[model samples]
Target chain A: MKPKYTSLQLFALTALRVSIGWHFFYEGFTKLLNPNWSSAGYLNDSQGWFAGLFHAIAGNQSLLAAADFLNVWGLIAVGVGLLIGIFSRYAALGGMLLLAFYYLSHPPLMNASYSLPSEGSYLWINKNIIELFALWLVFLFNTSSIIGIDRLLKRK
Target chain B: MSNDAENSKLLGRRNLLKALATVPLLGTLTYAGLKKHSNTAANNVEVLNALGFPKNTGLSIKPGAVGTIIHNNNPHIRLGFIGVGGRGRHLMQCAGFAPPEYVQDWMDKHAENPDDNRYQNFLEQDDLNVSVIAVCDVFDEHARLALEAASNADKKGQKDFKGITVKRYKTYQELIADKDIDAVVIATPDHWHAPIAIAAANAGKHVYVEKPMTNNVAETYELKDAVIKSGIAFQVGHQGRQTESYIRAKEVLDKGVLGKISLIEVTTNRNSPNGAWVYDLHPLATPDTIDWKQFLGNAPEIPFSPERFFRWRCWWDYASGLSGDLLTHEFDAINQVMNLGIPHSCVASGGVYFYKDGREVPDVFQAVFEYPNRDLTFLYSASLASERHRGKVFMGHDGSMDMDGVTSVYVDRASIKYKDLLDRNLVNPDEPALTFSSATGNIDAITSPTAKYFAKRGLLYTYRDGKRYDAAHLHIREWLDAIRNKQQPSCDIQQGFEEAMIAHMATISYREGVKTYWDAEKEMIVKGNSVKM
Candidate 1:
């Protein structure tokens, strides 16, 4: 027997998917506009556990050169996949992976200093935290319906 | 009394057992839950407070008037001016200095002794309203001189300075103890800056200390934490910091007008001897009136040398040299513009080439710092010498900016082209077909077959603009208003602390000849030779 979810549960799951998908898709599109994009800039400028990774990439001229091409394509692919809900689970996972790389590369929390409690403390809510939370929701809900290619592909 | 009687009537062995066992258990659970809630609430308050927001006040729409002056809803602060020396005096002479009627006349009668010329021009300005209520200095002569100036101005119908009484404080300790004084404007020597600020905060007084908040790294954090806990205002005197031009430039940069910035180069240079820390030695300072011991404060105990006491910027004990003074201001301006705090790590190298005044800090210095977002290469070369590359240049991948009184942003258009359009495809080859028209003998080859496929090539666009800013007075006005309204200022104590923290890291890098990194989560620099110190 197939498992059945309540109407409320189904609605919640669908809402979670759409919100996270839209967020990921928008972020990817914006990053795609710029010509000059690379991990090396973030790498050389970061000082954390991943400093060595940044330093290694910074020294690799050939790899740094290829990063521009990869970044543009990566963002576009991630955006389309999320927005259309094509390969829905994979898209969600990919968005998280890309954000994780960017987060580790620069780690916004490590360098930010707040004037008030709201500005600096790495509490439950922040940009990185929000994005990570959205990614987690995608995993939790496992939703791929409503204006999605996944449902259509399943029917076929 | 009724509740107690009822409790006694209902008392039984089972009831007692239940009360004793279950009630205590429930009480413990309630206490634990309440504590958890309290911790969460405290953290929430802390976060809201740091973000310039309060739970009860509701969310405010932060106005983005970058190059425009927006009149803030703040009250007129009753400013009490302490020092009337160089920078202090200049600020007072401005049109915005005068206070109201009651205090203006009292300042007039007290300054009748000396017919001083310095206060003459200041009195003539009708709008100058910085009410000089109290002016204090260690040297009784300078104190007397400043008092006399305020008195002369007051007598000459400069009614705003009317009730200004010049009190002679032999030490900053006396000024700190004064119950009437709400805040202090510290224009003291570099060594005394931190101590006086700390003392003022402890005495429940706000401090607007002259730039480079401290001479060392450790003191900066301590002072920052102290001010935060005390719930008082602190405005670090890097006057140009909150200017419109800088603020606008920052907005544009953050908006990615420069396109994923990776490199920032900042420079502070000077041509003249005065700019190079070559000030003529004053003959008046002596051990009797100057209070050399008080000047030293928390610095290592050393003999009273007149040079160290007067031109304190030259000595390491009293100053961080040009880095702390000049470069710090630039660094702060740059940081404020970018909204970046301390860099992840910094490496500095430089030495003193000229002006062997036995000063410990080098006349020249350069440091490369790695911020979380990007890398900042800072260079400070001061000579009793040449002025080349004298201004600050902030170079980002999208564009570059230069800072004077105004900050100018310039973009290189070609830096933003779409990627796939620029790449050549060698996967498939097509041969050109030559054909002759029946009517004409002209042969045309199929031109641009590649145009049939792929998207249009988009050009990378460059944009540039410049603006001049006057925000020192505005910043002060904003702070005063916040105090009156119980609102937070733009750059509060915590923001000031972040700016000061970067200077400490730079100092660490320069002093230890090693890279310095800060662990933001830990609120400490990761252990290194520089951080260890």
Candidate 2:
């Protein structure tokens, strides 16, 4: 038996999910609106180990073009799924995985340029972890009992 | 009945949550208000956009009509000059330096020629003349160069400065005692300004002392007394006061162009330590002709280090750290435009985060000055690792004018929308247009247009006929002209003392770690440790 959420907890989950979904969906929509845009400029400017990966990706313009399209589609799909509360757990897991790949690729927190690793990198608590936990907690509780379209559809 | 009780409880909880949400918003508003309240002025002129109201507006002056145009050479008193160093030298060869007579004349002839090299070359030369002057140091090298440049004015065939001769002085004392010299241009190092100024005033000669008036506060009072007693003409070298852009800014503010100005922020950005204040040490900075004793005059006596003499600004002993070097210029403009003489109190906080070359002066500093009456606050700040902000921003109740030495006035456009009473609620409520980045294109519509318009307008500046002739040339002209006509110089001794006092007080405040109050009547610091005076 799973514990059910109070109305406040349900509202908090819904707000977080919607915010994350919109953030991604907006990013995708903007890129789609401007088809000439690419990550090539940023990749060229980038240095260190990431430089190799960026160069490799930028070299195959056609393949990277497809990847760019997929990246936008993936963001929109994940955002809609989370916002609708349909496949919410799966969406959260996929979002985390995608973000982790980016986090590893760029690793803004890890400044490899500095003499000492501890002196350089800025490692604050990642928001992805918080969202991941939120997703798990939502899965444990029965959100269908709360005030959402999910609950209405189940009742019908 | 039972349902009503539950409904009331639910309503009460909702109201409590709303109240909780209001706390941060209220806190932010109050913080901003407090900042504004701290910066009010004593006069009727509210601190409009941190820059005061434009003193005078577009009452176009018809040529030769009342207040329209004063002949540069029409002044009853002529100017005589002494030190022709960095600023002094530029003033000397103004005609030859840039905007050559040929260029200006050519521009007038070919007014439609935008693509001509003559115009671009003219602008370039005009900018070159504004290079910071280097007056004679203890050594003969800088002085020799200055004299060479001063004498070369004749070679350029400038007719206005036909008869002025360049005279070199091995020592400033020799130049001061000369009978023909009526006024002196003191452009020595930061520490030497006060003693030389006092000596000049006491010797019955008027003075045009450069910016960062004095090294400390006590000298300010001494210099003030000397000038007052001598009754000589004195002009503080805040050239910005005589510029058109700053004057125009004052006019725009006075007209309530930005509505009731509230917050003023002045910022300088440098991405490197040297850009901030790192003085490069020259290998040849020895105590021989370097005048180590003279350089450290009233500053705390320490062992003769070459760095201390050459790059005195980096050390506290030879300079007022940051305040004297940069803050003086900002304060002078602020005071001139806003008429903000003395602040009620000032609190500053910052540290030297870059350049670990054992320099004592803070590399970065931010200080807030509070004034009385309507909320008027002056924020002064600088950083070595970033370059986002500029010299100053005067924020008003309605709009803000972002300004600095480079840009005269940058008015925010969102402020313009406030004129329509019906549009009051629509300002910040508009739906933000979606973009690839967080940057909304609408904000660009507000800020960039004005920047472009102002850029095209360029500098609308005019100098007195003999402007930038050479310190000695101008000083000599003023002196001889004054002697011939029995009149006063442009900047009298008293004015020099007052300008110098601002710098002195700034140094005292930074040194004592307290807000040093200026007693204008007594011309001394009213509170804190009584320094030298």
Candidate 3:
């Protein structure tokens, strides 16, 4: 297949995927090493429409444990998959879903509130939603075959 | 759109569908794992109860008959006084101990007004049947003064307490050994509190020990075990346990009025030298009068300095410093309202900044305790050099409670969960939705400077039927009633153990310069080492 996009555009798209992969990998790795760490505090302080659902999960010990394991491992799996450009599209899909859950847990919609200090103000969109869209672009562009391990595998 | 972009979008859509299909499979696996690993629903109820919210709205072991004295037609409980210093003298007074000169002076000071509540309460002490049969102290003057006060109970104009004879003992062991003494009140230095209480428990005598309940973590566990084995009534001296505002706060908390508390801030402040534990050394506290050896029981033997004898709270050898002397009060008060047993880990930092005297404890301190399981954090701070009063603040998602002298719950203006309630005026936003104030009349009417300060801060007492009752008196009455009823007092040994462990963790963290943790399985404080402040 002949190259479709300019080289610079392809490079930018690959860089975005790598950067997001690094962010997810670091978060998961840090949490994995800290045995006592839990997401209960964040879930318990969830705001907006899904607050009750988040609280219910937080209150359920078994459910919370499962959620913590899945969340941490899923982040690592997706990050590694995306970083190596193996199953990159699937990684983007999984990342977007996780980001959606984060957005729903504490949506930045107007009038939604939280007691914890915020880093910045947002109306209807925040970092999670923005990253979800960025992941979508990465998934649509399918740059893995252009410069990633997917290209080497295809050559075989 | 470009043909290449369209082709990419089609490919992405196909891939998204395949990935999305795996989510439900993962969800099913997760559900199966949770079902296999999670505790039963019934177990969650127990976990929630352990997290400080029991099914019972009232945490009191015995709920009704809080302030009333039930005679049960039993003989007056024989009581003994141990370590009768400032706090001991106060407890003695609460138990109807008043010398003739003291009563007469109080009456004269109050202009002989028969309606004066303090004097009136003394006159109405016919119902408090506790008879002080023994007095003990290492200090001769303290023991003598306690004996004199106990002997002059008739001076309160109460005919029932006439001609009482209180025998004096030179040591707590002798006092506890007395056959006639049915119960013992311990208001000694922190080092002596647990030893005397444990001995009293083993001697088949009820105990009322001052807080912090033990000098160290090991003593706390030992005292708790002794009390449980002995099955005697044990009350830790956290008088605020009986405060009306705390009871009301507990009720409100049980009702979930201030939903899901995540953070609590408690503070203590004092400006006077005496409040900083620079207590006055009695002029007669010489080596001849004070049995310095007896007073230094289990503590390092130091030359008899009147400062160490009178102000032992300033030293680590005899006390837990601010953690035991002051933080315990704040912790107990909050515990009564919130039932916060203990924190998982604590980090503390402080130092002796103000009083340059040769004291060992810090004059300013701050500690943060993290409760990972409960998803809560408690912050405690104290300063002896500043008079700026900071009360306890419980911050929750729906509302926040500010409890200083009064208890007030304010709805969070930006509360998403309670937005509809706020909009419909179900929860008011302008003012506190619930307010509990113990003050009813003019604050100046309270004569004692101490009483005035407490009343101003809503700490000393609470009003019932338009009449004020001292929290200490109420607390003592509760202990006596528990003894007669064979029920647990408000602040029992288990509760005391929890309070002491947390307080000791803060002290240890500050002294050892490390984060402290509770080893629940071992029932000990982790990384705890006794370091001089």
Top candidate on lDDT is 3
**Leading candidate by TM-score:** 3
Interface RMSD of each: 28.2, 15.2, 17.1
What lDDT is reached at residue B224 by model 1? 80
Name the fnat for model 3.
0.00
Q: Give TM-scores of the second chain, every candidate.
A: 0.67, 0.65, 0.80
Candidate 3 residues lying further than 4 Å off, grouped into runs, are A1-156, B1-73, B112-117, B156-164, B424-430, B438-461, B528-533
The segments of candidate 2 whose C-alpha lies over 4 angstroms from its true place after superposition are A1-156, B1-88, B91-136, B156-167, B272-274, B277-289, B300-304, B404-502, B518-523, B528-533
Q: How much is the lDDT of residue B350 in candidate 2?
A: 71
What's model 3's lDDT at B246? Answer: 69
lDDT of 2 by residue, B109-153 (tens): 556643333444334332212111223446444455455444443
Question: TM-score of chain A, model 1?
Answer: 0.71
Shift of residue B152 alpha carbon in model 1, Å = 5.4
Tens digits of lDDT, candidate 3, B361-433: 9999999988877789999999999998778888988778777556666778887766765675554455555
Interface RMSD measured for model 1: 28.2
